[model samples]
Target chain A: MTVVGYRRPAPGINPDNNSSAYASTRARAPRHPAIRIEHTLSEITGPHFETGGASAIDLTRGARGEALGERIIVTGRVLDDDGRAIAGALIETWQANAAGRYAHESDQHDAPLDPNFAGAGRIISDSDGAYRLVTIKPGAYPWRNHPNAWRPQHIHFSVFGTGFAARLITQMYFPGDPLLAIDPIFQSVADPDARARLVAALQMDVTVAEYALGYRFDIVLRGRDATPPQE
Target chain B: MKTKLTSSQTVGPFFAPLLRGDLSQMVSAETRGERVVIEGRVLDGNGDPVPDAMIEIWQANAEGRYDHPEDMQEKRLDPAFHGFGRVGTNARGEFTIHTIVPGAVPAQSAQSQAIWQAPHLNLIVFARGLLTRLVTRIYFPGEIANDSDPVLCAVPAGRRATLIAKDIERLAADKAASRRLCFDIVLQGANETVFFDV
Candidate 1:
């Protein structure tokens, strides 16, 4: 049997591996140009994740108590380039606590870590390609990339779409974050429009009345051709 | 009409605690094929360990058939093999996987002719500094088919060695030893691993 491969990402949508502003990339970006190859069954087939495991969708509470911060609801749909819903996709998320400190041992930020907040969550997209997460607004934190460099408040996301080629690891920034202007990681994408797609928008309709604010962040993965290969 | 794709970001240092399961073991006692052990480290250009990196691998079953609908070939699918594994590098930047040597699979050229790909594992790397995930493949050394593999041939002759894993004797010396191999990844600078854009 023959398979039709997924489309390559549009130019200027992906970040350059050699972006100089991100100090770590200087030592990690490959110098050789990536070899473009035809996709095969290896690229079209990926592992399907089941929701029966210990996956959690809420990040607002822990075994001890509720996390402290402004409660918010984050929800969105996972779609392909043609805007078709991609159901059963796995979405994993992690972030710093409200005090701008991570629960990781490597985090050197002097802020306080919330004992009640592990700041991690995972969920599978529903049949409609929609997912929702309940969590607190993360605070901005400073990194050593540059003097006085503070990343905008954002949640890191790892998404596994339908195929191996559709895997994505990205950050979802909050709207109106002043740090977006100077954040090198956010600016790495050359296209202004493409960069803006990383920021989630405010949506009152998704907000839980008197409970939590709502934000919408839609994601688009690589799409396959409309036609399948002939036998 | 085309919609803009969402931009990528680093996987960050905090993801280790969130990866819920032990995906390092991809085989069971009932699984078929030659048992093999793949071990490696994730390193930076300066040769420092990247402990925060996560690696995911996908490959065919021992019969060279993927457990997906698209792989409609007539090969047998081992019920014990799911052809997937996910793990994070340790504090010392090391990782390991236990699986079998998959059989060669059939591919096609632009003209619909059959082409054979050598036994290999597809890998994806995600780390704290990489805004985008890196895609690569691991091919076993000494496979005669390596000479004609289309993907390997596409790479320049000088750098093809980066994609091949080295046979390590230390791992083979273990009690339950399988075929032990090592393949370290250099994210940049000299001897950087070959990354594919596909």
Candidate 2:
């Protein structure tokens, strides 16, 4: 290993090469190179294929805080490039309940108040990469930056370990909240195709229990390219 | 378990500008202070823009001066390498550089054998939907001196097998002496380049 501190590769491929660029010289030009193919569209990545990461999730019984108001259910699926469900994926969500009140002080806001809702849930993707969570429908809240601004109730999402790109973090917005138009962050994505990825569907919602309103969402996690890419 | 995307009232304000314009501050790690351009693109398997994605470039200046205290050297830097610049890919997922190629740099350690290693650039990527930053490297074409570099040796010969600059015979009309190299880094997926763990 110490020898690597000062060695240069020559014209041909050297099995000893050990750096970011190895054998850069090829008298011939390449239009493109094809590598492996690995892709996904869900919160699914296997351990064999993973990337950068950090801390951990707070799965302990409500350590995030106590429960708050109106009960609701959130459910979703994770898919692959072929649109197949990614099994055993994990889906986690956290939000402010119907009153837009969080159990934590970081969200400091004044709105319809709910003393009992802490807003949080976790569900692992089933065989078809489908996940479900039981919580409450969160209410909209105000933002100081833009006019006519009230953020629709939404939950934050993080997907890790399905290997295509292994790590993903995004937000999920509910239907009919009416405030998607003005939020600068939500509007940052100028492409409607890209923006549509952030919007959760209203039909994915299912009425499973009398006390809970159910919702379904599907996520796509990228997979590794099976072959080397060309130029 | 619950996580908020980025608290609009908290961390949101700091990164929101990235979505609006030239996005100079949104990306870039740091620099030793020079003037130059960096070009590249963020594409999916089908050659598409990972649009609105944040592409950060960090590199050493002409004499190999890094903004990092560790790589901080008195070597005179070219005013052209300017240490940093940020460009968000357009609809096609391509980015270009008006900057100069950086000079050779010393490895990032106090190791006894450390000498000047070959020239290269480090890149970090962030987009609206992905969770973590993607770390990658960009190496110059035909820098034979890299063979024995410590950093290069750290990787396997097969994976190190990738990451080379694509061979080209033509120069841009405007570049009288500008030597150009094309390196298309692969992000793992159905039809993409090889994405490194870094």
Candidate 3:
């Protein structure tokens, strides 16, 4: 869904036109100490699990993920504290399998799916800041919105910051999801300009593995600045 | 586990972090009324801003007491009560709340105690991953009971006013009776909340 920062601006009742003095007055204030938290990946303790993963979008695995599907992998790189490539962050992803069904019991999708395909996977970045997961393209599904509200193709990803509070939670959306326009949640973003920030662009196209297409999405986690504080 | 990383191992690209939830989600398009906007900056002891922290304020209606049943104080309640709100700070750790000035709550102490605290608002701060939260009370000036209030005295003497708000005597020449209380909270860095811990 598209979301803008604080959409629907309130009635701004300021007599002071957006003047330079007002801006400077606001900028001079100093910082609070509580915000200075940082973490790296190895510090996170949650165990990673993929649900309904490894099944083919081809759905030949039947309603149960018992059969072997074509093997395709997703690779990504991590960034370091200095905005460089981080070599060892763990990237985990969970999603509905090829049949658009999750290992979660709450999911009521009645498509034939492989029991082995748990619809989830994880990959740790290599030395070059690269990581990859083996899975198939997920299918769009209908939600309760309308009698038939459908969601666009997307993947939920988690990156363990390697340490304490640095963990990141986000979703990767394929560039061209036609459902974006009608989605109420995505349309709720107050700032249309900022809403564009959430969409991911596809690269490394052409051929991933002949039958498998490739869409590369890179993510960055929160980290400390390399610059020392000024006196 | 490879704990030690040589300089060569530190190759990673930098991208500014993305906050998971959106603050815009907090604002609703439907609501009709005059909403007062209280805005201010949060600073550390060294006067630095804290980003991504949340500030909360809870106060009774203008009458001076909370609506909860536990409260048995004598303060008239104004039906126009809209004092509870939360604001998430931006990258600079600035915040604002819009509410009316609360009336003084008559001290529930016995006549012999005769203690009354100034009319004030309560504040709490919650930061990501912080196991403990920060709590402080904002006080208004000209409070006859400031001297006898137990919590105000709990704070060290030298910094009593840090917890108090600056009172505005008048807004304009012929304006109705109105007052603005300005309280700037100094967090622990080199500085700490005047009377708050955890």
Candidate 4:
């Protein structure tokens, strides 16, 4: 593998492109070109916080309430381009409930909402840039972005790096979801390997004896491709 | 080896619960800086309100210092300022941000020697059907520094106005939100907001 310094890399399609057919972009958004700005200490430094306070990762357990669904443990490390762990980075996530229904009022989906599941959590990375979350496997939900369309089972992630420019927000899909093959949001990525980075791998060690299954998802904030080049 | 960065996905319409959290405020009453209210609507190509969108803002403190370790400059860090704010659009596709008027930051490169950025807010927009989050900046109207802002100068002359928020009115004597500004974001039509790559 080749090594590069901490300088932010050049533009890659996955980091820049937004499909035109993506209904929202086609709406009243900018068609103008974006100006590329170099990163500075201002864009490189992020907020610092204590390991724990109100920040918690378990979404399944709320105040005197428990969400109804199959439990799962999602754990991972936040690394830089060099695969070095970045401790204290903030990771926030929001997902739909087990019935494929969101808790927001805007969601007109026919599925019922689970009162106990708020489906949101935030946590600071450990010394190894490691984080663990307990949540239900969100179900696939239908949408009209396209005819007869349904989003695949996935969770939304928002990660804050040292600076404002380092912010990376994306979705995480399950390892074996048939819906992934046809999902437009997944297909918009264009690069197969880049798309694959969104899927978590099963980890037996993290699984609770009878409580939950374990999945590992390690995120590299910026770096040379960790995957072998496509032939 | 060629590493492809992971692509972005929509935050969707369900981020409301998280939006209601306390971190949504960029500056609180205890914050040491001039307070301002940024209000605006999110319109679609058809001039319709995008009621489900979410907006987030990040900026430096009033003293041109960031609340980060890398920004170890001499300016004092305002203990009350966090420099971050988030809000979801209301039914009218409008959102308001209560924040301090950020101070200017220095250019990121030596090539632009002695160049300092005008006070501005970096914004990120999220909504349903948006495959990716839209990034942009809101510059204060009538700021002289804007004329030389390296990033602002990069925009096509006629389109520069799209990035500057217009001053609506100065708040009355007894208010914390000392200034008010309006900046409507057109998602795709005539006056589309200028989105930045970074």
Worst 10 residues of 2 chain B by lDDT: B1-10
Q: Can you tell me the CAPRI class of model 4?
A: acceptable
Every model's DockQ: 0.66, 0.03, 0.02, 0.40
Candidate 2 docking quality: incorrect, acceptable, medium or high: incorrect
Between candidates 3 and 4, which one is better according to DockQ?
A: 4
lDDT measured at residue A147 in model 4 versus the true structure, 0 to 100 = 84
lDDT of each residue in A88-187, candidate 1, tens digit only: 8888888999989889888999999899998888888888788999999999999999999999999988888878988998999999999999999999
**Span of 10 residues, lowest total lDDT, candidate 3 chain B:** B6-15
Candidate 2 per-residue lDDT over residues A1-231, each given as its tens digit: 011111111122111111111111111112233221211110011221111221123222254454555555666666654355666554545666667655554456876545555444445566666666666666777655445456667776655334323444456776655577755445544444445556666542376555555565566554333321221
TM-score of chain B of each: 0.94, 0.68, 0.66, 0.91
Best first by DockQ, ranked: 1, 4, 2, 3
**Chain A only TM-scores, each candidate in turn:** 0.95, 0.62, 0.61, 0.86
lDDT of 3 at B120: 63
lDDT of 3 by residue, A61-160 (tens): 3354443444444445566444556555656566666666555544677865566666555555666666655566666776664567776655666564
True contacts kept of 3: 0.00
Q: Per-residue error at A110 for model 1, in Å?
A: 1.4
**lDDT (tens digit, per residue) of candidate 4 on A1-231:** 111113444333353334665565566345566666655444554566565533337889867688988889999888776666768877888888999998877789999999888888887888888999999989899987778889999998888765566567789999989999988778777667778888988889989897999998876676422331321
Leading candidate by DockQ: 1
TM-scores of the models, in the given order?
A: 0.95, 0.42, 0.39, 0.89
Model 4 scores what on Cα lDDT?
0.76
